[model samples]
Target chain A: MDDFVYLKNVVTLELNQEKCNGCGMCLKVCPHEVFGLKGGRAHILNRDNCMECGACSLNCPMQAIFVKSGVGCAAGILNGILNNTEPSCGCSGNQSACC
Target chain B: MTTFKNPEKAHSPYILDFVPTPAGEVPRVTGKLKLRDVLGTFMVRWSVNRDNYRVSPGLYAIGDPTDSSDVFVTANYKLSFDHLRKSIDGLNAWILVLDTSGINVWCAAGKGTFGTKELVNRIRMCRLEDVISHRRIIVPQLGAVGISAYQVRDRTTPAATATLTAGSAGSTKPLKLSFNGLKVSGGFNVVFGPVKAEDIKAFIRNNYHATREMRRVTFTFSERARLIPVDFVYGKYKLLIAFALFFVLSGLTRKGVSFQLALEEGPYAVLNILMAYVAGIVITPMALPYLPGRSFAFKGFVSGTVAFVLTLLINFPGLNFPEMFAWFLIMCSISSFTAMNFTGSSTYTSLSGVKKEMKVAIPIQLISTIAGLVFFIIGRLF
Candidate 1:
């Protein structure tokens, strides 16, 4: 996992320090271990490692985390641009198995 | 009345038997995969019969689950269902399969199919309360994107004035119940399981606890390799069109474009495109870790250059310098674009990151391709 790194400083994940109560929910749901508890607040441990999966933000009880999360797939983004819709895995009809 | 579809006939070979429950007859499944199941996985890997690769969605019993047995929820994709069952072998459990339209859990969760609404609806439809005394359901960790744990634990639906249908197959008659003024919860708590099905047993053995390692997703060599077949099959029609277009373009000569010239130069042009395709779709994914650049587009460019150089040195088609350069441009652009698309199949990548990378890469690829075509025609005319 350490060796397989994508782009750096491009993640949109942001956590509000004031709202975080150090519940540790973000740390649990994040697949990339992007958050860490410091003192009594949740902090970004590794921003570059964040894949913006939305699990952390969705699970956070205090609504402290915010990220424009979606599938990081180039094909999905391209499909969205071409079709004039939100980014999707292009699993509409007939063509399947994008992810 | 809709005809009652037999579960055995609908989901043949997978259903071992049906166990009668208070709700209805729940199809019984086995953890041990049969020969056909193995073959089915192999066929899916190669994109054969892939669209129809799904199991019927409903409640299933494994190892004679009782009222106190843990109810594990999973996607309707046969692979997801199979993995869940196989991982919990020798354990008595109930499986609640959601209709993810044959997609795996994580992907379906991302798309909102393996979602909170679906989970709640399935639970009510299956009459899980009658079958199990416990008020807990275990979901995969990846499915957390679509399922809010607090919501599942607290959100209550108005269970009034709505007809509750039990089975999709019409085997069970529609039951009407009036629990007036009672706001009904999903009737269960959601506990997210480990990210991988292989860890389900360990998590269960440890009293339903998942370690940090189990929660993290990794893209190992085998994982990346498994995705190659599907990625390779993507946009194949576009590849064929590129071949057809290039095959005709190669026919351009000093006199005029003709089939004779195409016959002479077409093989070389087609071969170059094929090599580029292989480098991008196959070699790029397999050799991902070893590749030099962070950007998939850059990594693909490097691979394409190596391939182009090898072909030029060993199997030169005796073309002019301009024609060769044109092929180089074409190969790299094709490889770069295709490899960039691999970000979708990859385990870790952010939407912002891909969007940024594509903003730069797509324009360069387009310009290079157009320039290559111009150079190729100019060389042919001269």
Candidate 2:
């Protein structure tokens, strides 16, 4: 967070406060501190900081968080383009890894 | 006590002997980190203690686990176990360490190692029915991807009669369904209650409660720090490995020279490869956030040019302008390749963004490196 400023507003990580129990599952799993607990519920402090890893969404018990997570690496993309495959980084799916 | 990497696999025959805990009773132990554990944690980060980095996967007791002792599940990556154990200061719990190929919960969950299937199977194989009185199995929140709370709840302790209906797969169905047909005769309930440790115990103890049922999870800075090493390895090591390979191959491929003469010229080849390493591996990452430019390719070029200039000024003063320019192009191109690879490790880049960057970046980098290589070879021959 010290020097890293990502491509802004890309992470569609949204949280429904009414459903959020603020169990802090999202807080623990998020690498970028995207969600913070305010009073009794969870709040998205910085939407831009999200890398779309979907870790928060996966960890959220209430199903209150959402993100269009996927592989953001270069070679994976280049390989996908060269091979004409829709390269998935496992961000959108829950079953496999992005690799 | 039991030790099996995969719950689906047979319990290692020696598991009982390996651990002193009684069968069906995982001992409760605080996951306190001693000096050795601290050392292993650091060693695992750098990947030096590869063998020493993992704990045996199976059922473990933190202190002396009883039927009522809490069960905290984690991966066999010893660092994860160590941290979890350490985090529980006064709590007595049975730790069910999963065989995640020595990866932590966050990573293993992504790969499906720390999922519902493993949890349900492990619970049955360990005879958790006899060990814990509670029907609940507390898993890390991050492991939710690999595990469906509904599946785990359905398939937990009593396995022979496990039934997972197709209706349960979709979110539209009832979130929590109780099947009377799958109920046991003794009224013994086996449910996959994947509760957070922090929510269950830590938050209550620390008075981390709101007016209602808000249970807080204590996420320490130290625990969060573990994720950094993987990212560091991903960012730094690729170009370093490439540099080493290039150095060895370039030293061997020199023509009209004895092997010894080629060996004698190894330093030049090393320096040439070193340029790419310095620019891509060292400077670019160290100054990543500050490296001016939206494009990583441009950032790498800038860093590579700096590396080329520094090496040229210090080591190769006799080079002509053409030779210097050729070397610059080569270094910049190689550096660009290395930098572009860092896109995955960066938070800034996305799938669409990287796809766009690569279509333009890769061709330019390839052309510059190739042309520079040709010019440098001609410069050397003339």
Candidate 3:
């Protein structure tokens, strides 16, 4: 029922349907239910739902997905911009300086 | 005999000459060493000397450092050493490397492996007291948690400790160095920058397995996959229960309702449930930023109110004042409950904030949902 909508148009993921095997891996891994099964193939039903975690590509056996993943948090991104360093969501691989 | 490299040729503004040991006494290893480039930019390499197995992770005097040479401290991990050395183009500082289980300073400090005890031990092992005349040793600022300036001073005889920024160690300006130290006042102030965002995006993109777990719709899948006999049995059970509940409630309330009346009540109950579900999960996250107030509960209330109005318009296009007024209450209750459930995902809401919101929001949501369901059932039955 919340009327406020997020306006940020950051594209966090892409699906190459040509390479998709309809394995439903992306559907299962996405926290936002961004992908759904259609015609026996996976389709991005809601790309805006993506948080850009990049889990689908890692778990994809066929490598049919690609995304520019990082911490989607604004504060973390701002810090990265100010320091001239790469921004991280502090959950990529345990190398996080901030939890 | 090892010859002294000219101090003038190796002079750098960032590098200083500390006390030096006797020329022959200093251990020297010479060879064309090959280093593996790990993690893209960081290089991990080893040097071999006859009868000495040096496979990285140790302190070494690179080139010839004279007395008063700048003593720079670093992790024994070859990658850390490489990063430090690569930045110093012409500096001939004495590298004091500490064994950190082959991990970087920030992570090592977190794990407590690069703590105060280890730093003190490493200084003693290197005979830094005798090699450096100046009582000062420079450490990385990130390693401050594991090291206590007070503890290091009390433990070591005359050696004082100073923390430096990792990237700015090469800067020649004293003002810049001072500013770097002052800038990183706490763990949050440490410069993670865009690397954090990049890493988060990369993690989400690569780890599809986690996404799969999140998107599994248990309720819908159960409804779709169950076979005929089970579905038939469930249907019969539902009918029998509905009939029994209707008569029981009617008798208890001193009011009688026909079977058709009860059937009419069922559809509105289902719609309210559907609207609640959509508002809670779908609408909240999609429109998180523009919610009317900073408080998540307030935002949810606003969203719920909007949804209620939209539903009224769509469902009863030609309804009169009385009909519309009656439906408004039901719609408001359903939407409010849905929006209130959105406290889970919002970023600004802290744990305490969530707990507080839930305490008030939950009772109201439960009361409204139950009341709306009752009204829906009664309105249909009558």
How closely does chain A match the true chain A in each prediction, as TM-score?
A: 0.93, 0.78, 0.76
User: What's model 2's overall lDDT?
Assistant: 0.59
By lDDT, highest first, what's the ranking? 1, 2, 3
What is candidate 3's CA lDDT for residue B165? Answer: 36
Q: Which has the greatest lDDT?
A: 1
RMSD for each of the candidates = 6.9, 7.9, 22.8
Chain B structural similarity (TM-score) per candidate: 0.89, 0.67, 0.34
Instruction: State the C-alpha lDDT per candidate.
Output: 0.83, 0.59, 0.45
- Sort by DockQ, best first: what order? 1, 2, 3
Judged by whole-model lDDT over C-alpha atoms, candidate 3 comes out at 0.45
- TM-scores for all predictions: 0.91, 0.66, 0.30
**Cα error of candidate 2 at position A76, Å:** 5.0
Q: Which stretches of candidate 2 lie above 4 Å from their native place?
A: A1-3, A9-46, A56-68, A75-99, B4-23, B27-53, B134-138, B144-266, B294-298, B343-353
Predicted complexes: DockQ each: 0.64, 0.24, 0.03
lDDT of 2 at B92: 61
Q: Write the per-residue lDDT of candidate 3 for residues B158-208, one digit (tens) a residue.
A: 321233334567643212223323431211111111111112223234541
For candidate 1, write residues B139-172 as lDDT tens digits: 9999998887766654423243123554565443
